[model samples]
Target: MEHVYIGLGSNLADPAEQLRNAVQALGQLPDSVLVGVSAFYQSDSLLPGQPRYTNAVVALDSDLAPLALLDALQAIEIDQGRERHERWGPRTLDLDILLFGDRLIDEPRLKVPHYHMQARPFVLYPLAELAPVDLQLADGRTLKALLADCPFVGLERLPH
Candidate 1:
């Protein structure tokens, strides 16, 4: 199985429950196993005027290919009442493939190591909790280093 990291975020419909439910749903993916999950973090929205978000990272061991895994994640979002009314808009559930087994992918519908994960504390902080300390980014920085420079500092770890 390939090691995969997924980022989860929700700002609508009981955001905390949405994250917990998403983690459970991820465990049910065919040929996949949920490995680890970080404590949920609350952060201000990336876009002004939007609600704060509940965010976390999940580690998985999966046999599914990257695209298939992406499809599964999108399916979970849709199943949980997600709507694409706006770009980076508030959502009921958002699941992003942050990293897929050290593989880099650039596709029309998906990007691995998620394009903006490195720069966003909402993603990086929770990810740091789950990812290996030595995990390297595309820019050749370690996850620890990336966390040091993450500009978004509003993240507050939520209770278990």
Candidate 2:
């Protein structure tokens, strides 16, 4: 099984509970086992006019391929009432494939390492908690180094 990192966020309908339920759903993916989940964070919405979000990162060991994993994630989002009407819109639940076992993919439907991970602390801080110290980007930069340059502020770790 390959290691995979997934970013989860919710801004509607009890955001924290939405994320908690999503994490539980992730553990039920076919051929996958959830390894860990970072602490929930309350962060400002990245896009204007949206409510605050509860964010987290989850680690998993999965035998599914990247595209398959993407499909599964989308399915989970749909199950959680996610809508795609607007880019960066408020979501009931959002699931993004952040890193797929060091694979770099640029397809019409998916991108590995999440094209914008480095710029968002909501993703990076939680991801750093679950990723290895030696984890490197496709360009060979370490996750820790990329996090150093992230300017996103106002992330607060939620109490357990």
What is the number of backbone collisions in each predicted candidate, taken in the order shown? 0, 0
Once fitted onto the true fold, the runs of candidate 1 whose alpha carbons sit more than 4 angstroms away are: none
Instruction: Predict model 2's lDDT versus the native.
Output: 0.90
- lDDT (0-100) at residue 142 of candidate 2? 86
TM-score, model 2 to reference: 0.96
Q: What is the C-alpha RMSD of each candidate to the true structure, in Å?
A: 1.3, 1.1
Instruction: Write the residue-wise lDDT of candidate 1 on 34-152 in tens digits.
Output: 99999999999989998999999999999999999999999999999999998889999999998888787889998876987778999998887888788886546688888778865
- lDDT (Cα, tens digit) per residue for candidate 2, span 90-149: 899999988888788899899887987888899999998998767897657789788879
Q: Which pairs clash in model 1?
A: none
* Clash list (residue pairs), candidate 2: none
